[model samples]
Target chain A: MDEEIRARRAACTDTFLGNGLIRPRELLASIDPETDPDTYGEGGVVTELERHVAALLGKPAAVFLPSGTMAQAATLRVHADRRLSRTVVWHPYCHLDQHEGQAHQRLHQLIGRRTGDPEHLIALGDLEEVAEPVAALLLELPQRDLGGALPAWDDLVGQTQWARERGAAVHLDGARLWEASAGYERSPAEIAALFDTVYVSFYKGIGALPGCCVAGSAADVAAVREWRARLGGTLFALWPAAASALRLLDEGLAEMPARMRHARAIWDALAGVPEVRVVPDPPHTPMMHLLFAASAETFRENARRLAEETGLWVWPSGFATGDPDVVRAELSVGRATLRHKPEAIAEILSGLCM
Target chain B: MDEEIRARRAACTDTFLGNGLIRPRELLASIDPETDPDTYGEGGVVTELERHVAALLGKPAAVFLPSGTMAQAATLRVHADRRLSRTVVWHPYCHLDQHEGQAHQRLHQLIGRRTGDPEHLIALGDLEEVAEPVAALLLELPQRDLGGALPAWDDLVGQTQWARERGAAVHLDGARLWEASAGYERSPAEIAALFDTVYVSFYKGIGALPGCCVAGSAADVAAVREWRARLGGTLFALWPAAASALRLLDEGLAEMPARMRHARAIWDALAGVPEVRVVPDPPHTPMMHLLFAASAETFRENARRLAEETGLWVWPSGFATGDPDVVRAELSVGRATLRHKPEAIAEILSGLCM
Candidate 1:
């Protein structure tokens, strides 16, 4: 099944997702070749990016890293070292626990404790119930695994406050903070202000080359920079990634609010499609998850047929759900989705249902 | 002194060094934009690079990494875990010991035991002296810190055999193996065959984007791949670096012999200059050290004046030696250096002396 998708990938002409399917070369082409390359993640566009991100996040400093996994781990480790507590609290579906191969424990000697239910956002009560001391509370803006849902503003504040009162530094896994910014009608800095440290990814919401930055006080960021060097995240030249981020960052941010609106339009139209359901219906951010009332095989066959007939690429296969009959797919509103009318997209997606 | 160099860097028209003073953009432009980007260091050019490197090194598998620091650390841990030993033997000036922020000790909890004299390659006698159990013996080909030196081929074979007899895996830190290949007149695979695992760097000699590959048996490479993910060396896309390496690797290897001869040409020419001395005289590799019989301040002032007058950038400052009056600079024969006659380069270098 996996091999089938690879065989047919090049057949599709238009991708129904962010930017394009294969984009590194185009991203590199967009960069200003004249920009001096970074040496060991220092000088040139890398430093410029750090300074710009620090200002955007309203933090005293920032450090660029190869991946969000590295950024988040180093930030958490720095906070833990400062507070002298190894336990860090997070939601059950957070990237650190689910996707990072236990790097926090294996590489950094930090312990991760889940505080929230698997299906819901982290609440004040969940954080308060944690009995042990915590070095940091890791919060994901627009929690990805929960279908890009962000908690209400006051509830968000309450959760952070609980950790702060208990001497735990609040750290943000803001990989999708740009999407959250549009959802909350707030600047990234406004949401970031509540956290002691923030790690935002450029590759996702910013549509840049793969890279991220951890922003916080000058002291904390300096420490992460050292950790980055130790972890080998400091490459000889980070300028290409930095330059790509610089090139697309402004346009990506400016287009997010419209993407958020576009997302709502699609969801609202899908309301008439009985076989398709959206989590966090009405769409809290520019992204959402769609549940199709069809088996995985049925969904994949439909997706392949659509790609072959219309030259339009959709999710090849989807994540399995608790119900064997249903499959889940992610749709993050982007330029291609904006090209079609909301009613038209709903019709296309409806074609996938059994 | 650093500020002065930074201020005059842009004034130079040509660089008296490898490739050029600033080379990232040119290296990127050489890559084919149509090449697919890697996803999490899998597929696309990243996999292509891994497969190509594994076959070239005569290994079963390989993994592409962002830096040699991560590659070497992961490889060492893999060997240690298999041997059930925590101690890894190395030279005092090895990258893991001197440059990687003690990552082996801090991140992996592996104890490093330096067994050789700081001034020479690891001698067979040094290995016999270590009575403790050893997990691996790390040997750097064309040892970068020691003026890009190599041990005698017979002695190298003897050392690895001793480690193998003790049930210790031999690992090659072949960061400059391309240079060493030309020096030894041996294929990289020929040298790599003596070790259980081999790490080769592309950024230094290949003049490509910053990246490296670890080649070994399928199981060991898989283990290092897992460690790479844990350490966050796995980015969303490693294509740009991988593609750049693919584009330049063949040409870089083909040019090594010429560069090696050019290095000896310069060395022989410098023999007449009286004020300059060459370490490992007559040059074993394409890279060698030039010890200037002048104070640090004098070297800086002369380098600045040379840059201003000839528009040729040279080393701004040099590593201090035991002698207060002498400073050491490395010259690795490259495209930029190839443009000049050996006598002309010698005259230019002579200008820097008191």
Candidate 2:
């Protein structure tokens, strides 16, 4: 059944527990064509969104790209070129390693040196392990795969200082920066100030259509725009995605603090369940991994049944962990999760575990 | 002023000569949300369009990319990897060289060896001059920069055979393949069948949303899909573009033959105008360059005046040729061009030249 749930998800009209973002039809319907006409990778709403994002992140400029994979790679390539070094230091479980098919090396000729354990956050000690000159240090705002874990504030500052001392540019993979912002109690600009470059996804925390923007110095962003054109990220029109992002950003960004609070309450409710475990103990962001002490087959059966009865899409089977008896699913609090009380969601998860 | 016309064109509600493709708002309105939803660069209308394009070009498979720049680079990189040679041979005026900011060399580590004069099409003799092992030979059908010129049929076959004998991949930059097909009086598949890989643009000749597809063997297209993800071209949703392309393709592709006929008629009407010269003398494709003896400054002034008075956008200033005096503009026949009689368009152009 993975195919079965995919089919069901396509047909299901119910609000679900996945990303819970607005669907494309709703997004397209909401966009105002008169004000949001197509832009050839520049000007109009696309440029406006970029400027708005740049100011929010306290950067000199920003360029919109279609994917984080391209955004990060292009940004790092810019940093690498500036420093005249090809080596990039990042965590072992970074999106670049897990998802992008070694694009940094194959496409951009940038070498990656994994500097941290896959199960933990990168430490100052991790940077000390690299014996050679590095072009850039890439850090995820909250380590995603390890269940939204963030290093101590002191460690984060020390890591940036170390990279700067070595003349290495610091880049943040701030894919969920909006959600991560609340836990830090700092504006995006305050947090982004530490890095030389930042990559943020609109589809993730902003709940917009698929696209991303890289923020940095004007020169850096200009270089990224050039690379974006080269990488095919600069479409003839980015207004649809930009308009949706701007609208969703206006609605959702301000609510992130509340969503983070709600996420903790849900975890609190689920803490008593013996068969369920939330990664990172107490959530640092509005996202966390839920480990269920149930077999994949059993989990799929319960998930299917849950969807059939409640019209809720909790866990898609493809996200299961390596062990057949243990499964993992990520919970990213959104409008749908806010609709239900913590007790109700906890009970549903508990039932699945049982 | 250029700025004045840009503002006016944005506000003017008149049909124009440039491109004359479907506007974004109109295209967005035409899309069927009930039948067309989001696809993660996978199934739905996106896949159907890819399959349709693949069949049209007689390729085993096709993958939609967000831009032609990404499509061509990814395809070339794949070919280079397969042959273990990074040198690609093409004309100096190819889009990869002049337009893409040396992305092949900078991003993909591919060395480009420019062959033939920039003013003419590449010949079999041009390939014989390359001293190194070439991974791919990229040919632009109806060379856009050279006034839509195409080599003789035997010469075209000879060039492909030369590349094949040298174990080099032959790829076509068929941005205007639809128009080029009419010139050849051959089906797109018949022309594309001679190459190892073909890149087609939806926004150009097809007048769809900005996106392209690289069609070839299953393995080759699969490799392109991988690079697409790596390059950040794999959008979480491409249905908007796919849906519009599918619709526009159904509407516009059948009219390409007629568009070509209309292009010839326009050229025939302008033949006697001494101040105007159509590039490639006897136009080879539906698209041809119109070189006006008037200076670039005068041309822009005339274009702005014409648009103000007649609500017809002839060409933007950014497309002007290198020379200050001899202005060159490309005309790609579309629905809007079909609206005016050939004599009317010729008279309008002749006035500008004067």
Candidate 3:
């Protein structure tokens, strides 16, 4: 953001948007001052998080990791070592390809095979075409890049079954699993049961500190823990992250349904705005992509105007689209978004079009 | 520890030994409750720390890493990439060889070549034997595994000069550089200037949260920062760790000289005991190894008796030596060790031999 918008954002009395910015005072406020800390990834709050997540996901064991990149790479490497195959299958838009700097191939020597099309997720047909031996298949629920899309329950089951028939391990990139549970109206354990391993994020949707948990069978988890030490994720004290996660997790779990409901309300409210288009019409999870019927320059002007007049920071920038006149923005309806009425938010967002 | 000993340790108040146990309240208590936080390893407190350490070490830049394992590996990898050589030379008992799970070899595809005798720190004579091209030579200050030994200043400069003459980058595993500074009676920057890059720890001697910093030229630090992101050390929030390090680092730095003096006093006191032998005599740093005349079993019995009678937790176990008749224990004197008079501590330690 430029100086004027930055100043306004800082001075704004209350945020109409929240990324759960972890201010030191705010982040530790929820944790006990005298809480016992963990040592070297074992005991204390780290163990508490591991056990809580394992039981919540109905897994025999779980290990809290410092990040998801290490968690998934280490998990997949374990599966590869067991199956004696280095190939992993996932969507073309998977995080391993785009965000992780290809750490799997560089660090683990595991080959990544993009099975499904980039514009869509893996279907049973996509899995059938993979005739070669595969170590594992990774699936992201409510695919964020696809505007929080989710597969039908039957399709999801069919896809997992196909991977199993081929003797391949199945893993879930359940970073937003809480949202998925709310979307499917099913318990997290029910959805987690179909996978060989599941990785969940505490910071993204939950608004807790940065950390993640990988849950699976005891042996797999033990293997991952060993890998965690090798990757240098086994810290001397993980209590700060673990304690924050433990304190806010149940609250996040309970609040996700409401967030999902608010997302739908947002879509309904936006339908009246002629210049805005909501992906999937209604969000499958708590997040969605909004295509604006305005140029990037025009969107900036509208945003700046709203910040000056309404004293609200809408967005710093909007992503450019293929067409010069259109722009795209992603909206993940959080507690802050819930505070303002959907109609009021839509009214402010419409200004971005003009 | 067994149930009884564990209970005793828990109940004991005000220890004569400190390892900076980072209980949440105690760790964060020093920071302003209203301080802003850093995001993804950038800005706010992490920036403050990076700048502070860089200036202290007289380096152009520095980047904070979650663990020393990642910090050194990433730094070595960058040096290797620049030099196009895979082999890194260090002592046989270097952390990379003894502690890490061979991550440099496993993850970075970098070969490690031991260059010195396990019993001694690397000397100029050791550097002369290296015929093949090397990417880097890692030297740990006040080598912990070797009873906190620091190379003589002239010899240290000569060794680093030899590595540079061979077109190899010199890296300092300055994990205990604070103590080394006290031992050498020189500024940290004075010693750091002999190496191309230096990695320092906060949790070990500083009593801060678990983390470390690699300081060097701007280009090298920028590269390590990229690797940190790929390694997943770049968290959504690093404020807690950075803030803790920033708050406690100066105090730890200031305390090292006094701790070093107290270490000398402890050695003098131990001289009066017949069964206890202190390594390096007067001490090269604020830490040393204590060789006991008793066997492992005898040491445990004496330790138990002391804890039960004195209500002070002591050694739960001691290392078995080749003789099996003698045991060894390491002591890194800190603020806690300084609290008790050196004579009193030696009197207590002497009982373990009986």
Give all TM-scores, in the order shown: 0.98, 0.96, 0.96
| Model 2 RMSD in angstroms | 2.1
Candidate 1 local lDDT, residue A149: 97
lDDT of 1 by residue, B222-326 (tens): 999999999998888888889989898988899999999999999889988988998777688999989999899999899878888888899988778899899
| lDDT string, candidate 2, B1-354, tens digits | 234554767755555363573555776775676544545687777888899999999999999888998899889999999996899999999899988888888888899889998887897788899878989999999899987888888899999999999999999999988878888999999999999999988877777768888899999999999988888887788887888788877567788888889889988999888778898887888778888888877887887777788777777552566776688888878878888898888888877766
**Model 3: per-residue Cα lDDT over A77-145, one tens digit each:** 999989978999999888887899888988888899997788786898988898889999899997878
Q: Which digits, one per residue and each the tens of the lDDT, describe model 1 over residues A1-354?
A: 244575577667777676656455567776887886666777878889999999999999999999988889989999999987899999999999999999999999899999879999989888778888899999999999888999999999998898889899999999999999999999999999999999998888677889999999989999999999999988888888899888888788899999999999999999899899998887899999999999999998999898888888888888999999999998988766777788988998899985
Number of the top-ranking candidate, with DockQ as the measure: 1
Q: What is the lDDT of residue B6 in candidate 1?
A: 57
> Which parts of model 2 are misplaced by more than 4 Å?
A1-3, A15-22, A36-39, A318-324, B1-5, B15-22, B35-39, B318-324
Candidate 1 residues lying further than 4 Å off, grouped into runs, are A1-3, B1-4
Q: Considering only N, C-alpha and C atoms within 3 Å, which residue pairs clash in candidate 1?
A: none
Candidate 2 structure quality by residue, lDDT tens digits, A276-295 = 88998899988888889998
Scoring each candidate complex against the real one, what DockQ results?
0.68, 0.60, 0.66
